[model samples]
Target: MSHVSGDLVRRYANGDKGIPADQVWALEAHMETCASCRQLLASHADGIAPLLDTVWAGLTPAEVPAKRRRLSTWITPAGFPWIGMTILIAAIAMLLDALTVLDTSFVLLVAPVAPMLGVALAWNKNADPMYELVAGSPRAGLELVLRRTVGVLVVMIPALFLAGLPGRVSPALWLLPSLAFTVGALVLGLLIGVTRASVVLAGVWLLVVAGPSLAEQNVPAVLHPASLPYWALIIVGCVAVLGLRADSFSRLLR
Candidate 1:
């Protein structure tokens, strides 16, 4: 691969706005794979060393500890509450199922979208206070998004599994749909924001599947064993698209 020109590296390191967006993107993307170019960029970035030092100098000794409590890049603090809420909702659904309060299995109905609550907040601009700084970083594209999404799934998948135990539903019935919706949100998020994409997909599922399933007191065909393959196909397709458009998340607009 051709290395980026020194002038472009200097301008990028200096935060020059005159450079076109595409060039800036290409340069950053290239730097991720090119150690020599990254070293060159680091050298150019030395010009900002004094500014950084000045900012650090302005901080008082008393305030240093507070500043050190930096947020995790994988998942925002706001995501915890949403994750908690999802778990609580799943428990409630399980309770409803055990009590025979609803003819349709509430556990299965809620399983697919349970992780969505956490996923939506995973990279939400509003939920994350450090959105600008995090999104502007060189590694802030698909990798960061996937990290946060995995963090959510790690917690949610087990919770959903246990919650559905009482309903005796096949794991595939809920697991595949959950995976599909989660990745589908990310795929659509390349066009809309993740938060909006999550909401839109969840809303559609509730309307088209959950609502009808509850109203008719029957499990939706989409959630049946026969539909697992289709859900798997959707997941594969969404993942492929996400890989192709991975750069989209790096933009501030996303």
Candidate 2:
């Protein structure tokens, strides 16, 4: 049996758990000569597992969006390109409704533009010349734009409801008009880009879609397929791609 005067060596080798003070010096001397034991200790190192990995019961999943996109974000932002203007327009609409200058219902028009133009200009700005070459490229453009449109809508929706609350317009009336108007603006914005070159985007859209649609006081005329609601609804249908996967944009860029 190994024996030692140093307490440390006695403790380590014989399970003494304690040893004389003189044995401490003997233990140090033994350790200096023991290359094998030193290497064994080094291999054990700190003997600790990484807390984050080892303690976790399971790994968290990764996904493109952690949460479903909020429609509110699209509401107000879609109505205007500039955040300031987007914010400003919603504020003005609310104010106009409050002061009796305009119907609280005007908030509807402001909501859609944030999404339509906001998405359009953003897509146009980022547009690689190659976007048009591939099939389904427009879908990608639509998704990116639509996501942005949703952001605008999110803010505008609440502002709209609050603005109308004071005016005694039923909530349903405000919401339907906003929805109808958003549908209208989105279509008008997309279509007028094809029409008069002399006109700016919004001005042309305003003259063609908003002006005409509102002029048709009859709900049936407003809903007419040749008119704003029809076109707006169609454009909204096209923009439904927002909720879909973005693989199309990647392919289009390719």
Candidate 3:
């Protein structure tokens, strides 16, 4: 496993607040999953031992418990609003479908990209105010990314299912595509960052599928049953790429 530099750990443990925030964030994030680095941090902690003891003594049992309840590693509070927005968008699409406002399947068009918005927000630095702390947690790498992705899927899949109930679109048409796009975002995210990757994928979907479908007043051929195998292939390929680049998620910038 990659480890933090010894000099950086020593500076951090010596209470050197002058360290750049990005470097600090990276170090903390790396140490969370690296036992050897954690040990290195402990070795350098003697310099700050007295301060730690004093602070520890100042905290009362009641005050300790008064801290906010720990959130699940699967999802952060920052992701909740985006998830709700995604559900709202699905509901709106369903409404449009029910009212026959659009000739094409609006529900199907929206379903595949719905969960992606939430996945983008899941670990985004700009979206999550507590990103530093979250990144510094023990679950900061691909495990954390997968957990948050699962969390997004858990809420979005049900919402999409209910939304599609009012439309003629079959779940498989949208479901496989949704999973494919979500995992594809992660695969691309290893290089470009999750938020940008998601935006690019969504934009491409709108241009290639949703736009043409609406203009033709018909669901695109890609959303047809025959295309399910292609979507499945994309998902499998993205999953394999994600597995190979798993370590990329440990960095602060991503």
Candidate 4:
């Protein structure tokens, strides 16, 4: 039942003005644990009332039809299907390896680019229903893109690792290339759309690496241990480029 003094709460809510630092901190700390004091502070925030009204009025009708959801609400529904598909692909690849249906390790061949597929969907204007709304925010762009990419990766990397486990696939065989390819997609996405960039990278890999490697029954040179240092360099270079060009993603093409 204890509370910050009404006068202090009112002064704190109205404006810091001449309030002492210790008093301000005390008021804030009390407000954190006191709902009645919070209400008192809100009541004192007369100047903010009109602004709050304006913001409430601007809420879309679509937003009011249901109870506000959790942080999961922020993730677009479009991403779920794509994430599922990415998981299914990993599962199927593992199954194929288990059955020995393929002459080569199908899992390794796809692992590098598999996660990017979901990453592409994570921010694709075509896939995300709220892309315009989300993309238009000032906090959008590379920061948001990287966050979503990380989210996709969180689900993907483990799945890929699990798939590769039974086959004894070396993490180096797929992990480095995966980072390199993901960074490549991100860098390319700044120029083109992320989805298109993913398609281009996947297509090129299929045409130039996967298809040939399969036909010749040889592991691609890029995925070989001798080539790992090269892949490491590529990953480093690409990440540096991404950091330098991070600003470009802010004004990314729709």
Output the TM-score of candidate 3.
Answer: 0.73
Q: For model 2, where is the 10-residue window of minimal lDDT?
A: 190-199
| TM-score, structure 4 vs. true | 0.70
Q: By descending TM-score, how would the candidates be arranged?
A: 3, 1, 4, 2
TM-score each candidate: 0.71, 0.40, 0.73, 0.70
Which candidate leads in TM-score? 3
- Reference-based lDDT, each prediction: 0.86, 0.46, 0.86, 0.82
> What's the CA error at residue 152 for candidate 1, in Å?
0.3
Candidate 4 per-residue lDDT, tens place, 1-254, comes to 66788778777777868999988888888889988888988888888999998898888455455776567533446788898898899889888889875566888998999988888875687877777787778987777778777888888899999998988877778988888888888878877888999999999998999999889887888888888898789888888888898777666365
Minimal lDDT window, size 10, model 3: 58-67
lDDT of 1 by residue, 1-254 (tens): 89999988888887899999999889889999999998998788778889888898888465435456766656666788888989999999988889986657898998898887789877788888878897899878888889999999999999988988888866778899999999998888777888899889999999998998898998899988998999999999999999998888888746
* Residue pairs whose backbone atoms clash in candidate 3: none
Per-residue CA lDDT of model 2 for 58-162, tens digit only, reads 576545666775654332222344544556666786676576554224554444443333334333323323334422445454455456556655655666566
**lDDT tens digits, residue span 1-254, model 3:** 66788888889988798999999998888988988899989998886788888898878454445669776767767787898889999999999989877767788999999898889986688888877886777778888889889998998998899998877678878899999999998888777888999999999999998998999898789988999999999999999998888877877865
lDDT of 2: 0.46
**Model 2: number of clashes?**
31
